[model samples]
Target: MADDSLFAQGMATRRAVLGDAHVDNATARTTEFDADFQTFITEGAWGSVWSRPGLSKRERSLVTLALLAGLGHEEEFAMHVRATLNTGATPADIKEALLHVAVYAGVPAANSAFKIAKQELAKRQEAAQ
Candidate 1:
């Protein structure tokens, strides 16, 4: 059985990092088919690894963003691009990571990720004062 305390802790941390509104919208968008997957991510990814003391949230965010971009997960890449703002990762850092992705992952993947990041960054900047 999933640990309720762990799940709760993960949910709290997830909200803090990802923001309540984003998490709420994600939760609201979850369907029955993906319910288990969502729980696994909450309890496993967030509760387990993210709660560990090994890495700062900022480091984890950087790794996660790079992996998403490298893997060509555009949707997740966009979400994490916005998430970097809260994790203290500047747009320059993200651009640098995408450049690295271009070298290691593939130019096409990096290009797509950069496009998504640019758009997301623009939206985020506009939302700010």
Candidate 2:
């Protein structure tokens, strides 16, 4: 079925972008109530949008960071910040995106995003040590 194939593709892309461990943990936590929501995000966000060819994963990652920060999606912004390693989005890239978020979204949103980003990036640095 088309939906099945799309879900498969979405899973692959999601794993690629978010990494297996992250995807596995999310899959493990899925419940009946949120199962459909998970599938929808996988199929719609990962398969349909992320899988598109016009933008590289890095570009997509930066854009996603900015949007999440702009909209004050703290948890998701943090998750995506962690995902930057797999997405090839450098810290510099994140800084630039957050700057854009400040101008377009608001200083308060960007300020919160910057704080979260700093914490995430610091955690990454500590992990590498």
Candidate 3:
């Protein structure tokens, strides 16, 4: 773990944002081939980007949602939708983000994201109940 403060911070942030169960599942599923990929995201995405103080976690959450939507990353988008609870992004915020996605990224991406978001939201609601 030399020269790996970012990785450590990223790992902690990832766990907090994604939850212990989700992080554990990801770790458990990591194979030799993809281990490096996971490490890079952990350090770069979680540590360097997410840990930055420039943007609040809530704001980052919304931006991430839009980007994921725009890029058609359905599974990742849904997982992030679930992360909103920890990041403090409300449903209204997500709705508004998707609106931006529709305008800038186009209707199709936002449309599909909305469907995925709805399903994930429903699942969260059900789990809460």
Candidate 4:
């Protein structure tokens, strides 16, 4: 975004959803060539859209999971699933979302997403203990 304030808002929203640790890792790994891309998503996706008031972050998390699963973005889907820690998406919500993916996105996409989601969820649960 052209406006620094808007970009800052995006950064905050992104961090809120993705968690500071994940965002920090992404930032640390950003190269000069990809820095522009980072800024664009931070401003456009996280800042402008995610910062909007229309949808709660929890609902956004469900929609994001469905979109990512349907798009076959397994990695991004898994990342967003991890983001559920902050987004308040329950395991049941993820299961329901994946069921939607199975119907619309096909069973294969849902299968992969379920595998990743289960693994990530297990990791989080184990870490919590």
Candidate 5:
């Protein structure tokens, strides 16, 4: 069984970072096939790691975005790019992180990530204004 306290903590942090609308949609879309996977991520990723005190949310956001990009996880990269705004990471910081990905991860991955970031950032700007 999942740790209740850790699960609660993870859910709270996930909602805060990803936003209620996004999290709600994600939860709603969870299927029987992936339910266990979702639970594991919440209990392990969000609760065990992301909730730790070692890194600031902003730092974690940067690392997450870069790692997702490096792995060619475009959907996750886009989601995190949006989440970065909530974590106090600026567009410039994201761009810089992606630049680092270009050198370390590969230019193709960074290039794709930049496109997704630009699109997501533009959407956010439009929503705000």
Candidate 6:
């Protein structure tokens, strides 16, 4: 698909996964320097990869969580943990993925990821209540 089409598709997917509020907040904070970076992630990551039909969003979410946890991207991991609500990734799925992280990514990474995930999940649950 063309870049424009990819960007459009990516924006839609991003919104669906991250929600309008988060997207809008990011958009609002976009600066001249980071504008291209934002577009790159939208077109490349969300459009080209996420838009693919090979895996369900739930599966993608799990993979993303594991990768982020493995890389020790605590903030992004927490954000994706919250995005699981829209991605249909359950707490069980997240636990399994974190277990994989522990085995492959190291106990320290998984330990930190687990802590962040618990905090984010608790915030979501509290909000729902």
In terms of lDDT, which candidate is strongest?
Answer: 2
RMSD of 3: 1.2
Model 1 has an lDDT value of 0.88
My TM-score estimates for the predictions, one after another, are: 0.92, 0.97, 0.95, 0.96, 0.96, 0.97
Residue 73, candidate 1: alpha-carbon lDDT: 93
Off by over 4 Å in 5: none
Quality of model 2 by C-alpha lDDT: 0.95
Task: Encode model 2's per-residue lDDT on 41-105: one tens digit a residue.
Answer: 99999999999999999999999999999999999999999999998999999999999999999
Instruction: List where candidate 3 sits over 4 angstroms from the true fold.
Output: none
Per-residue error (Å), model 5, residue 35? 1.6
- Residue 11 lDDT (model 3): 90
User: How high is the lDDT of residue 32 in model 2?
Assistant: 88
Candidate 4 Cα deviation (angstroms), residue 79: 0.7
TM-score, candidate 4, is: 0.96
Clashing pairs in 5: none
Judged by lDDT relative to the true structure, which candidate is superior, 1 or 5?
5
Candidate with more favorable, higher TM-score: 1 or 6: 6
Task: Give the per-residue lDDT of model 5 (tens digit) for 15-126.
Answer: 8788899989999999999988989999898898889999999999999999999999999999999898778889999999999999999999999999999999999999
Cα-lDDT of candidate 4: 0.93
Q: Tell me how candidate 3 scores on lDDT.
A: 0.93
Clashing pairs for model 2 are none
Candidate 6: misplaced stretches above 4 Å? Answer: none
